[model samples]
Target: MRTLGNILWFLLGGVFMGLLWWFFGVLAFISIIGIPWGRSCFVLGKFSFFPFGKEAISRDQLTGHEDVGTGALGMIGNIIWFIFAGIWLALGHLMSAVACFVTIIGIPFALQHLKLAMISLAPVGQTVVNKEDLTRKY
Candidate 1:
């Protein structure tokens, strides 16, 4: 089921979305100071590619401890990201979501887009993990 959904999503518009993320990530990397944000972009970009069966969760929650990415620095990073690239990515996702929502068969994809939109708002400190991992003892 997840494979089918991911294939459909990739075929529909996920490729574009993921490319946008990677584009931004490259830009951020070139800036040097934006390396952290670039790293987040790459990670989230992969997540954007095939989101089914995977979930983005707070790194702190997964580790049960705060790291650099789960600290105040992460918050600041997110704020900067929001001001620069986050808003645009979220907008893209939102527009895609609206278009998907127009058809019954697209409802699920629309929901996925909505989720991506939210994540795009503040991707810092988040880590993608398989759904099955969430239930495992770490």
Candidate 2:
């Protein structure tokens, strides 16, 4: 099921999204300031490529920050992201939705993409995890 969804997602437009993130990441790395946002885009691009069986989480765990993922900075960054990549990705989803709607089988997947695209806009400090991972006893 996950594989099928991912394949459809890739077919629809994940490739472009990944590449866009990578491209921006590369450019961001070129400068000292753009590096953070660029890296975030690049990392989040992976999740965008195959979002199934995953969750978007805060980066606090990774950084050991007391309130990394849900803080003032996160809020500000998210707002800025919504203004930038968020709107663009939402458009991408809208476009994809229209294309997918042309066929009956694509409706569900198109809706999924639309949802993910909206999430993509403010993906700051979030990570994706497999849904089944919860079942594994840590």
Clashes of 2: 5
Please give the CA lDDT of all the candidate structures. Answer: 0.91, 0.71
Residues 1-138 of candidate 1: C-alpha lDDT, one tens digit per residue: 999999999999999999999999999999999998898899999999999999988888776765445568778888999999999999999999999999999999999999999999999878899989887745
Clashing residue pairs for model 1: none
Q: What stretches of model 2 exceed 4 Å from their correct place? A: 58-69, 135-138
lDDT score, candidate 1: 0.91
- Could you estimate the TM-score for every candidate? 0.93, 0.75
Candidate 2 lDDT = 0.71
Over the stretch 91-128, how does candidate 2's per-residue lDDT look in tens digits?
Answer: 77678778887899888767766766766677777766
Q: Which portions of model 1 miss their true places by more than 4 Å?
A: 66-69
Instruction: Provide backbone clash counts, one per model.
Output: 0, 5
